[model samples]
Target: MEVSMFGGLVLVMVLVVVVVPALLVGLVLWLVSRSTSDDGGAPARAARRHELLVSSVAVLAAVVCTVVLLAQPVAWPGWASAPGVLQAITPFSVALVLCVVRAVGEQTWPRPRGEVRSAPLARRTIWSLGGARLRIVLVTAAALAVALVVFGATADPTGRAFATNPVTLPDGSVVSGASGPYPGWPYGLPMLLGLALAVAATFVALGSITRRPPLHGVPARHDDAVRATSAARLLGAVQLCLGVGLGGALAVGGAAIQSRGQNLLLDELPTHGLVAVGGGVALLGIAVVVASGIAGLLAAWPRAARHAGAPAATGAPA
Candidate 1:
């Protein structure tokens, strides 16, 4: 459905970006908490409560965003049109179900209280919420990057040029602009780049789960880290699907513009602008993912670096 510029922005920010991660993170946390909370102890109960809270917040946010998305009309033509309110209903329902599973699971999981082995960086990263939710944040950030890239690649460039059904435009109008999914070389570049970013994120999530290189702070041998990474990978895969799939749709717009005898008036700068904006969004995603991955990797490696700095057991202390 074609959505207006403002409508597009809201849909991208709320549905694709915010709601998806919230659902994923809340669900994962709830599941993990449930698995560990076997003893009807205070901690287990508390964890369940926290899970409920996260689920509630996520559901609330998704609902609000969906309402906003449906209420708003898309200003642009093919690129931006008001979507059916029902469009968001399915995802919302899915998110709600995930929340329910997590909340229920939290009540029955085994709870063990051993000395929490500290990861120096993980400690610092989530001093407020703790390490359990750190992976959630990472996954959410990655998803955000994915959405931003998708936005840049698919956004209507030449403003309202695409709004009026092109077939209805005056005769002899040289329509040389692109439209929905897989527009041209312009959109292809972002699609590929965004796809690459999503793949890289998947690799990083895997490494984090396995506690591989760059995930040093993530407790390489810890079960929690593994579980967290698994959740993160799932989220990343979703992000990849959305980014690549949306990009393909945008590229189609470019393909439509391939008519040789179409009106050149359609060759306005706004069309190029929309393409550029979309590309820029993908570029931003690339930057964010690369930077975050580097930061995470560095943070994860501090312990090894410290050990490397130390003298051997047989050597005298510095």
Candidate 2:
């Protein structure tokens, strides 16, 4: 049964890793070709081309990292019990790479020749570049990370075999409530580090987007629109990472708790509180996982460049 399950999971992973990226690359290529054919001015075409290139590079980097990680013959330390760590960290890694790519892309974006450039009157920061939605997503990710860390710290110290406390029943039998492996410190530590790195990368990327010279010869509003779109995508990636991480953490932790609760019930324990808590956590985790899918879509969805003089949207800076 376990082998069959593992095989099914591998198949699913292959489908996701291979199919999704192919679709995205195809979409990006279509956009690039479409942009090339458009009669837009040189500045507009240049902006579109640069944006599309960055998008393609970022997607490629993520796909490569994911394939390499998944293809490893052996699991990393602590991975046996916390398989969710891979699922969570994969997206985090993608987000981190995306940030780095965006930062570099912004810094190196083409500049108009023989044109005078001026800085914006106000200095821009990550907070200034992104809107309220971005901030909210960041906060949500932080909350989930904190929860994962706290739960991991409290996990039982048993290594390799089981992560939950063993329950002794009336029949002289010992049940380790949950089967081996839980998201203890071994898994949590890696996730925490990844989160920290992702945060730093996001900050740097947003800062670059804000500070980079405006697209040369483009209207200021168009440039602002471009920056805002970039920032949105970056934040969307961050949110997707955190959302997946949190969902995995909750699901694993909850399963452990639920197993313990079931054991207690079997042992005729006094109360069923743990069972309720575990179920709730698991359900919440599932919900989060679903929401993360939406976040991923938002991150990958292409935005058309806003033309000059268009009415300002809700998320764009004034």
Candidate 3:
């Protein structure tokens, strides 16, 4: 009871002190990203700088991890077995994960100052009330249906009790029972689908922001840029979400498969066998997302940099 109590306290503390702050910060940045244009201000410049920093950090971490592994080989769960070596390399893994997350957040970086000013920065209209909500409902319902089907279908025929205590294998190369007794597919499919729904909702929300009819009292050039920005932002966000979902599926699903290996042959599992395919999907998503963001910025570039680009008049139809 005491151990459980202590664990609960630790979890609560972690959530309050770490997770909540991270989430809040992410939310702020996301809103800012959607609102701010790439006009070389401190925020825009910072956004540009962040991309380089993340990429450089990722590459540097990979190189360092490779060097460390070569210097002192360790088992797969090195953190548990050879803590000293893994401790050094863990930073790199963490940095890589952070870089991936940051890239996803940055996918919402806005277009040119001129285009964004003409549009409503934080306004909602019929599109959000009608189209976006409809999209969300349809997508979420479909995902839930699919999740239920997969969950029920993947149930173990023999009803094997899941291992409560995970242990390292004798070979020390793999660990099993890192997850619950449920089949990997049952758990992973739902998670992947949930992530997908969130992505789809975000795309729809961004689309609603671009609901500027042709008669919107803005210049044609600015209107076109606004539409382009909306498309670019939505595409970038979609790619980011897809990549993250695929990556999460592979990681969690692979771990679950390995956990079940005491009874099941994970090597023969299609999900485990097709890791290369999963990686390709993730990489493709990341590439497309990053490309869209960069392209959006370039496309929104105005001929004049110092110009305070806004709508011709206040209260214009955004």
Give me the candidate number with maximum lDDT.
2
Backbone clash numbers for all candidates listed: 50, 0, 1
The sequence of per-residue lDDT tens digits that candidate 3 reaches over residues 100-211 is 4434434443433322345544444434423433353344334434533443354454221123223456566554332323323333343444444554454444444445
lDDT of 2 by residue, 8-108 (tens): 44335434533374466548566645754433456756676677677667666766776766554434454444444454466567678778888888867
What TM-score against the true fold does each predicted structure earn? Answer: 0.32, 0.78, 0.33
Model 1 weakest 10-residue run by lDDT? 297-306
RMSD of each: 13.4, 4.8, 14.4
Candidate 2: worst-modelled 10 consecutive residues by lDDT: 2-11
List candidate 2 segments past 4 Å from native. Answer: 1-40, 77-88, 115-123, 159-180, 302-318
lDDT of 1: 0.36
What TM-score number comes out for model 1? 0.32
Clashing pairs in 3: 177-259
Clashing pairs in 2: none
